[model samples]
Target: MCCLISAGGLNLIQLQKWNQAAVAKLCWDLAHKEDKLWIKWIHTYYIKDQQLGDCVIPQQASWMTKKILASRYIMLQSYLPSPQHQSMIRTFYLQLIGDLPRVQWKCLKFGNKARPKACFVMWLCLQQRLLTADRLLKWDIEASPTCVMCQQDPESHEHLFVTCTVAKTLWAKVLRWSNNQLCIATTWNEFVQWGISSAKGKAQQAQLFKMVFAECTYALWTERNQRLFESTSRHVDQLAKDLAVICTVRVPPGLQTLIHSFQF
Candidate 1:
């Protein structure tokens, strides 16, 4: 059977012959005369395993079958089954936010209109690219992992991007420029959820929020890279300017016109 399947030269008649032989053997093994007869009849017209493993039958397969198969075969071996622990972690993370954005709720891949920043953050986190002061200390990148801008104990994603004084000031400037009023979040999760949930009604406000969020994240990351690589000092003005340029470039012309009109 294996050789017949692997040989690949079987035409319709040959395929039918092979299938009948296989099914007859299976039926004899099963010891069901009716089932054996049914199998023989079925294989008479419908040559089973004609293409064998050469082609995938998309019509007969489920959409998630591949993911399920891969996950079972691959991930199950490496990642232990800890559903309770993972659930606890996810719950703890979600507790920081009042409401989750619809995009996040749906678990859609990042860069969609709904949760672009969430997607980017997920990618960064998965890639281990995010530089926390703890990570810097552990890697011996610096003598201390203390935040340079605030001189705080440790600079984490939450602290450096959202809670640090320099970050706060930069966000303040950005908010002022965009004419938005937002309560500063102390946690990364909270800030993300806020970005997702806030500005639910006004399309303009939502667009501005997305643009500003993307800009701020890019600027903060850029500044961190410069400081880490070149031993350069943090520059809030440059960060702000970079953010402005990012927003200007990303925001659509219609929205830009609306923003300009609002300013006037």
Candidate 2:
């Protein structure tokens, strides 16, 4: 199962990449460790004194053996790693994984203090993959096209998080509580960029902002769900207060001290 993950917040091994790495290890062992029993067996049985790529996977081979042999083509594509060298396997692994570009909001989405659920929501928001009214209607699903909070514009990631009246009020209160009263974000892009540009380096304000930003996104989404599914809603002021309480608990001691000093 593919679990939700990010570039920074929580580190986890991608199973697919890890499997590729394991296969690369097998290739390395075949080339270097002739003394190994498994390698000896492969040479005696399937390989029969032939190159790895020349030998095809036998139909009757064990599942694990087939798995290892299956990687022969892939292993041959890259320059083979050095014999018995640690960097050899790592080089192959990196080659197999390839270099993928990161999203602009990666650090913010996976910050150390950011809650994983909130970070996941932020990820959806950044990808514009949330089930907003625009997406639902496009899918031919019968749903109101208007923003539930303001009921004035089409519900979308942009409106729900930035331009909705409830959202703007909540953001205002939150920014004030975070001692960033002058900061304003009218568009979704601005909201994301604010988090990225403001949180430059490991400044205390930056860390606190990342923590606060995560909590705000999570709380706003929760409020939207409650209003839609439960027919209940929190006032913007309450959301701001609740965000403060959550951040107080989530941030490290240094950030807690920084937040507590802000005038409510």
Please give the distance, in angstroms, between residue 243's alpha carbon in candidate 1 and its true position after superposition.
1.4
Top TM-score model: 2
lDDT of 2 by residue, 100-169 (tens): 5545676675454877788777767767888988999999999888887876888999899888888888
Off by over 4 Å in 2: 1-17, 43-66, 76-94
Q: Write the per-residue lDDT of candidate 1 for residues 93-149, one digit (tens) a residue.
A: 222221422334121122223235543653353233586767877887865577766
Give candidates' CA RMSD values in order. Answer: 16.2, 3.9
Give residue 104's lDDT in candidate 2 (0 to 100): 67
What C-alpha lDDT do the candidate models reach, one value each? 0.52, 0.75
Record all residue pairs in model 2 with backbone atoms less than 3 Å apart, i.e. clashing. Answer: 9-110
TM-score of each: 0.52, 0.79
